[model samples]
Target: MFEPSRIKNFVFVQKIIKSELMYLQKISLANFKSYEYESYVFSERVNCVVGENGIGKTNLLDAIYFLALTKSSISNQDALSINHEAEYMMIEGSFEIGESGENITPITNNQSLITISIQRGQKKAVLRDKKAYERISEHIGKFPVVMLSPNDTDVIRDGSEERRKFFDGVMAQLDSEYLENLLQYNRLLLQRNSLLKQFSERNYVDDLLLDIYSDPLVEVAVKIHQAREQFVTQFLPLFKKHYATLSDAREEVEMIYESEVGAENFTQIFRKNRPRDLAAQRTTMGIHKDDFAFEINGFTLRKFGSQGQQKSFVIALKLAQFEMLSQQKGFPPILLLDDIFDKLDDRRIQQLITMMVDGTFSQVFITDARPERTRQLLDNLGVEVKYFEIVK
Candidate 1:
């Protein structure tokens, strides 16, 4: 049997193992959710945080989610959830990753910081880091992450909006330029929509609107479409492979992009749809309108899938996303599973844990409602793992 001190030293080494680890280094939260002022240093490999409900287990994951892209996992929520009496919320984290034959400093010395703050009742956002002058896009490709939670099941059970968000978030994290263009495209889309509303009321059209909006809209819309298509193209093979691995079958899985009016000749399509859009008072085409259809055996799984199938598909999608990010971006994104065991049976859970431990993930953060179940499953693994219990 291993000595207690030896085990303690081993855990300490694992916590700071910057080499060969391409995942989360640490996470710091301030006035964010239930965490008034808390920071957690992560094991470069596998880390677990256990807590009772409402103790901020999911909130911890949300903090990382926010740090990655400055957005929440769920869109409909208050921005000022830092604390009841707080004026702003903040989250900071570091990543130990390598890119293009160069290691990204390897979490040595002080961590590279990512700070996000939202002032009370402010719609705009602000981001800063070690240096005062830094563009938000610079943080991309540094520390990439992917999240899996109960809400992921909504991609299958709910409307297409959630699924679209799933794709957009993944793609955005991988390609920062795509994200920049997407933001520009969206701003123009909103302005055009507002103008369309005015046009419907017979308001005058400024000549600059076409020059200012249409050209950039077309250019940015094309870039967004290309990035999404490339992501989907690269994502599908691994996605299907993971599905087969998870289900232990070759049940064919398919993902098709559905776009309203800009499937071909994006610029011409936008121009052609302009009159109808003005009449409808909404910009009804482009990347914002695209959706992914997860089909199995030539039938749409969103409607026809059994509960087990849906869960397996979601897990496979997440794993495939992780793989794609690893291959294209040179580091696997961090994986977080929230009470996933509750939705899966022992056999499925065993299969998932096996994949997780067998190099499928670089670093994993898991939460289980029942510690007994989590402990029992983890005990079967031979690799090093850390467990922390959160009370209150």
Candidate 2:
């Protein structure tokens, strides 16, 4: 889908700054996905994971993602990560913080250990440096990561919920306050919906209790709406810049945030929608109902953009996400590319290799089914790439 004559070339004069980068030095997996038990040591600059299709390259990357985020990048179910024959899963990663590239391999200085284990019908346990975190979400922003894969195309092709989830995940990682507010909003919404159902089933309504829920829900909904608006404003320039470069400056693209919260009678609308809400047995209007309209030259990209254009758009979104997180966190986040080379042409792949040398990312893990192709691309680039070949 990423058809292009030539990927736009970026002029980057910046040099690599290693002291602020956080990178994974080692990782171990047990009963996780396709891995029964495995341990890997990674290079500080670039790690190339090469394996035949279905040989678990992506699962390996997911292990790293799970260690960083305490959940699967591919799904919401922790049970799915367990091997078919196993009842539990465990992943542990050793990371180095604020270390220079010149530091010795497996440098013990400033190292941190993060481990997560999940068992049948039991909550996942997470420990950082052997001390448990009270909540899993608290570990999210501590070591941020950005991942790009073929599945990212869903953010454009799917309905509104997919788009909201992608943006919300980005916001949650960059802003802790935003994450806290979003968690609270979702909790309140669930309870309020249950009360609505209870009111209808029993033919009883407590106006005071309803009012209590409605007031707080409305307040947080407005805050989320506003935060989303601000996020889009800040995110626009970066997204547009990356999109323009990826597309070679062809076609104009825009993202319009659609929300009912912008209405002057937002609070009144809640009061007005109560009867309908009771009939529907759900909270139907709020920031949860918001959507993002992706447009190419004022037309919906989903409806009009070509296959090549859509792929470029999604990749650009991830690139912008990388830039934003790096800027906000003061160090680049670990980048995981899941066999992306197979999707791009030699010329387009050159753009990514160039960015690697320009310090666009601190540490990157790339999976390629064809090791020769990866070698051909990096052979003369003077880049340090450590290759890992998996055998079935």
Candidate 3:
């Protein structure tokens, strides 16, 4: 997307990715995960992190990712990202944006300093160029990122919650309004669930008080459901296109979004299910139960697809995410590949390598435990490739 590479009859080329102008120029980490303190300068094109297994390669990638999205890719709790030897954590990144080239030095005006820090028993802080943001949500789309990992297949094979979280994250990165709606929905759901638990413990039913929480919860749930429905409609075609190109065999792939809120009787059913909800001590019916089902040839992918097929499907999903975010944000997001070379088969790895070399992506960060294999593959790519060799 960053250069005019001739697109041949390749493995995956259904769409022409646009020009990418954003890239991370540098990053520093303090008391974050495995790094007590570390800093590195990066190329504008491709970066590979090489190390032995469990030697903090993925942690380095997550630090870059944390600077982009202001959140960890693996853990949900910010405290968990803090080093065991420290009481707080900090991550800082310098990004060269608004232009595209092989320039080693970025213009001061074009560089952005993004920093995130968290202390125990305090709110995490996210800042841009030393000025703290009033709302961290404002930083969502500024530095978009897509992380592909071997465990991503769990989004397909695992419970509905994983699928919801995966798609919700994708939608949140692109749509601020949808992100706001999702946040509100989650807050309302939590409050309503607390009320249900309270009702159960007290052995009392306060219909009027319950409505106080239910009304807003249901209202926001509808909005969340609509957003998700619209997202699936827009995302499915791109996902299927990528899958077709990656698999090279069109077996009729589909992503179907199933939600209880789509039913006409959703409100009635929700009200009727209060007793059941109270018994379970949680909200039982809403967009929270929504699921995205992957299918190949009308059969459930999770149950029917082979391991390689599942990997291809999830990788396609991530690639579709990358393409969509690039189109929406007008620049390609930073791509993070976490131990994917060892996880993916030879054919898929070659396809990915070709894409990275031939300019389908910009500012890519890859993690591999095998340094020899990584060097063998990336050494010949005619691009600005840099390797951060980690030694534990």
The true-versus-predicted C-alpha distance at residue 311 of model 2, in Å, is 1.2
Clashes of 2: 0
Q: Write the per-residue lDDT of candidate 3 for residues 1-392, one digit (tens) a residue.
A: 21233224322322323223778888899999999989999888889898888999999988988888888989999899999889999999898666343442233337789989999989999999899998898898888899998799999889999988899889889998988888888888898899889988999989898899898888888888888888888888878877877777657788888888998878888999988998999998888888888898899999999998899899989988988887787677789999998798887888887777665777789998888898889898887789889997
Q: Quick one: best lDDT, which candidate?
A: 2
For candidate 3, what's the RMSD?
Answer: 3.1
For candidate 2, which ten residues in a row score worst on lDDT? 7-16
- Could you tell me every candidate's TM-score relative to the true structure? 0.85, 0.93, 0.93
Clash count of each predicted structure: 1, 0, 1
Q: Extract clashing residue pairs from model 1.
A: 31-82
Candidate 3: global Cα-lDDT?
0.83
Q: Local error of candidate 3 at 164, Å?
A: 0.6
lDDT tens per residue, model 1, 279-340 = 68887776777788888888989888878888889988887777667666545667777778
Considering summed lDDT, which 10 consecutive residues are worst modelled in model 3? 10-19
Candidate 3: the clashing residue pairs are 1-359
Residue-level error in angstroms, candidate 2, position 244: 1.2
CA lDDT of each prediction against the hidden true structure: 0.70, 0.84, 0.83
Query: What residue pairs clash in candidate 2, if any at all?
Result: none
